[model samples]
Target: MNTDRKPALRLENIVKTFPGVRALDDVSFEVFPGEVHALMGENGAGKSTLMKVLGGIHQPDEGRIFVEEAEAVMTTPLHAKARGVMFIHQELSLAEELSVAENVYLGELPRKSLGRVDWATLYANTDEILKRLKVGFTARTRVGDLSIANQQMVEIARALTVDAKVVIFDEPTASLTDAEKVVLFEVIAGLQAEGVGIVYISHRMEEIFKITDRISVLRDGEYRGTLVTSETNEDEITQMMIGRSLDLSRRTARGEVGKTALRVEGLSCGSLFQDISFDVRQGEVVGFYGLVGAGRTEIAETLFGLRTPSAGKIFLKDEELRIHSPIEAIRHGISLVPESRKEQGLVLGMNCRDNITLPQVSDLVAGPFVSDGAEVAIFDQYRDRLEIKTPSWRSAVGNLSGGNQQKIVIGKWLAMRPDVLIVDEPTRGIDVGSKSEIHNLLRDLAGRGYAVIVISSEMPEVLHVSDRIVAMYQGRVMRIFDAEEVTEDSLIQAISGIENGKVA
Candidate 1:
């Protein structure tokens, strides 16, 4: 809005290269003071790389970075923060055992006489920031005790601790509830009012359109173009980010519905979820839809033997089974691609081949040691089958993009040849192009007669990929609807614990 003002932060012709890849290539971007500039791209489009350059995590091979119209060299993260650049990363960098005050002023805590921490000053300052943000928790509260949303508030409060001219939010709302997101938007608005520039990175188009003033796109490490949010549309932005318009239509019914492959009757995991009942037939994809903390992931965990059901009956092919561990679940022909791939699904330090074959490593072993040939064969099979884009089988899973990493997780589970496959938030942080691919892959899996259960917070994803959707609210099933008959309004109402305008 302030066209005459100098940019709060600017990157000119930035180029960053890694082994076998140019992560960023001649990409230029600028964020004006008080502007919410959205950096849009598919998963591997170099947005993260560019942000790293700005955060001084990785130095750019070539480019100039200007802060407030002056060229500055950000040699380290400390230097970047000293230069008024702050990053609120997706995976929070807070020490859980520390209090909110301590986490906020982590590295630069105020000191009193004799090098002791000035506790009173720290708590007072943090309380003021918390009050300004209108957050519920106090500065004295331990960060580990707070919800994910409140923890993020601590991160935002940390940004305000310094004279931050620019704040970078990387997928800030990925784990937030709807009410939490509203509060976050309010905080962002307040920051804008204070003339602080924001660089927002997210895959959710709706959030981008709603909150951003300007949108700059990147495609395959190259700068595409920038557009004023008010003047552009999602289709145009999608084209700019992916080089093609996406098919936003729902998936048609694929594969004949057969006998029930998995059936859960009266499933209960204490207060996490209650009396949950569902059945996934052979060659069908059943989507579980809800907001965060609605027990979607908990239900998946329960099904995968990560949690014991207080009261429930699990049946595979109409045969009752007691599964007490993940290995037991796998032995019963059930595989779970967990919500957090980095934490639960794959070993980041391990190569792609090892990650894929890990679940079935025992079976792949020879007389004494593990067989590399067996592992590579399984990896190659799934790599080609899943179309994972890795440099090689030897490439570490951590080096791949979000979409590819997700595919590898799926590959890991798929190698077990499970009768029932549950993928939780299958395309959470992936870009539009990869999202489409994952959606299709789920359907294709169903077509191949592997019963699929998709647990998603994304409404469109559930509607697009599911044959039948189970909407949950506060750990209870609100309603079940055939995808063909489900309306957005109805689904929203169901997830909100309302049916036909009354509380469900």
Candidate 2:
């Protein structure tokens, strides 16, 4: 593990602060050559702030950064990259319209006489990197046409373009499938073999244990102790991050199932999905489980009137309806919590109160003027109900943590008092504690007679909260099993399009 070598990158006594918040406080961290160090923390634990300090995005109030035994002042992102520090962020920054090679060599494209781009050299260099990564796509392939997993490979290729001594990966596998994760692990291993240090940040414990050598924890901007990966366990790490051990057990309390609240018949959305039929009863949680691109999100969008179905029948309380828009869906007593909270769910520039009352702004008007009293009342109701941790109702939604931002989205939808609620990827980037809270919140909502449909890619989440599970594969329902009757192996097989070792 190169224990005798000097650290590839090191930060000492780092402190960063905003106007009203101290994001980082006296934090110290180091990554050795050829080692994978995991930065563990719950959302808003100062992990992002610390990374920003390292990336030169935000200058630390007090700190020192050293690269290979020499002090380095990273004044900008380009300076950080020049010092052999590269970051592959969670949300990729690649130019989607450009080719893989162009995206890889974005700023530093090879130039010929008179500043004309040297396309031949650029493609040749990018092809060598792609071949080394063993990816299937070519250098000339358009990045927008590639899958999410392959696009991530392009991000990694960009890192390799420089003489990177350290690479930071922030939740790289959040959108990848099980098979794709294996490929990512192989790539990380190859980097480790070449003596490149890696700083891995993710909330998934399984991946941390499988890929990391050391785990350093943070809580509320303070540095916790670091533990060797082999010597520490998930329980210990959970305690370090959140100050308490988590309950990793499944949901045991079941809500009483009543009459069907929502039913879909022969729902077809072109090539997205075909002949999909499912029903969610009152006071019950129905989980939809599938791999990425398995048409789960597409079905939810169809039901929410974001997309028009080619052919289908939607019934709410046994009455057929044709929903043409999101407003129509909301009027029909159906609400959707979209997958990407930043993109479709919340208005980042708006305050918490405004975001929560946005859908019902017209109703909130007293007489030709929106009532601030009504907006604050609704925001306060859901803020306490959802346990959203914000400084105030006037705080910008974008300043909150990922978990809190997600709760605001849910609270916004909950204000509508819909008969049926659809939540997609409820805990995609949330920490362990917040994930448990959100899971329990879904169950509590169901017990309160709100029909819930949870669409998740994580198998444990689907199994933990669902009363009945619908497994889909390649745009078709493979099977539906009662929570008590489903086995992990059987569920995996169903989602993989295999039943009893044969294609379903």
Candidate 3:
């Protein structure tokens, strides 16, 4: 808490560039020992780029890293490791089929003079590390059998094995439950007490304010500013992250929701969801709210035909529509911008133009060939409308920022011209500016009379964007509230099985 604490790690005038983008432009940051320093920015604001440079995943074009007031060389993960720097990423990299012991001792398993593996020592070491991190799962359990929260704990345990002095956590709680998050926070606090400097990267404002001692903001590969956590507020941090203040009140009230465009009656997928029914009226935005693993995604998948509803009926207007596959759903004027956009939504190797036309390209094709001109006109329209930041339509989507990639997904769905559109966590990893853009686009679509269904874990987002909000718990609709009538407390209460001052 002292202002005079010395920085354990310092990045001086760091510069990194990709093919068409300068990922980091003279960005500088410092982290003090025994303190939690949060790296704040929206997606593509260069937070991750700076972290990668420090972790030795990406070599900077120009910069100098200093550890303990001495210049350090971080050319590779090994080099970083040797300097007591370790990185734990959002996506875990543990082998599921392997036992915890095997994963912990991965390539450097203990051995005897006879050249035989020492399984006993490996398990013992794994157990010791897991205990030190306070992880509960057994060392013999398969990683695949563990929950996402526990898998993340295993990741932390792995880092502790090396006795790292500086640790970097990138979006560590993106998929963790509240209870799991508490455990992770406890471990981090413990590390801080041990004088281990931590760099925390996250999109959640609450987490940063709660955990960090100092905060740094990066925008478009440039260092914006750094502030003490006690001296800054969320709005200030958000403004710095996006280069402007965001008007969170831009979503206007749509006059009247019309007749139902899509209806789910007694929808049940047995273990996934049961007796779930909701009606999405034209010109209305409805949100499905729940905690992770609360069946929100399963319901969306069922509606999109990724999973067959064990028992239910889907009505598109007056006629019952049987959705057996995604193709059938598309034919019935339904399109879904799935969660995990990078993995399931867009083809990584393909260009933006190609992805936009993927859902409905037949209209742009001549007798037996695709019409490049037609595709260009269509892609250009949405790209411009969505304000996607990219070099060209020919640019590979994989090369774009996470926000741009999400815009591409939305553009792809728009190309389909669906009567009902489903977007899961539409702004999951986007920055404030991009989040506002995407939210406004969805509002515009609803204003144009498209039935929009948004599923999100962020409570404020649901309250901000929905015309009607449906709270789901244990795969069933717990309660429904008009957006205007819903407060954050009420919404959380419904989702958590509390209502009217008692358990529902």
| Top lDDT model | 2
RMSD of every prediction: 1.4, 1.7, 2.1
Cα lDDT computed for each candidate against the true fold? 0.91, 0.92, 0.86
Residue 279 in model 2: lDDT: 94
Q: What are the per-residue Cα lDDT tens digits for candidate 3 across 142-194? A: 99999877888887777777767799999888767887788889889988998
Model 2 per-residue lDDT tens digits across residues 1-504: 867789999999999989988889899999999999999899999987888788878899999999888898888878888999988888878888999999999888999999999999999999999987788999999999998778988988888998889999989888677877887888889899989999999999899999999999999999998999999999999999898987777654566988999999999999999999989999999999998878999999999999999998999999999999999999999999998898889999999999999999999989989999999999999999999999899999998888999999999999999999999999999988888889989999999999999999888899899999999999998888888888899998999899779997
Backbone steric clashes in candidate 2, count: 0
Off by over 4 Å in 2: 142-148
Candidate 2, residue 381: Cα displacement in angstroms equals: 1.0
Q: Which ten residues in a row have the lowest lDDT in candidate 2?
A: 246-255
In angstroms, the error of model 2 at 309 is 2.4
lDDT of 2 at 212: 98
lDDT of 1 by residue, 1-504 (tens): 696899999999999999878989999999999999999999989998899899989999999999999998988988999999998888788999999999999988999999999999999999999888888889899999998778877887888888889999999888776887888899899889989999999999999999999999999999999999999998999999888888788754555989999998999999999999989999999999987778999988888889999998999999999999998999999999998888888899999999998878888779899999999989899989999998799999998999999999999898889999999999988888899899989989999999999999888898899999999999999999897788899999999899778996
Candidates, ranked, lDDT: 2, 1, 3
Q: CA shift at 19, candidate 3, in angstroms? A: 2.8
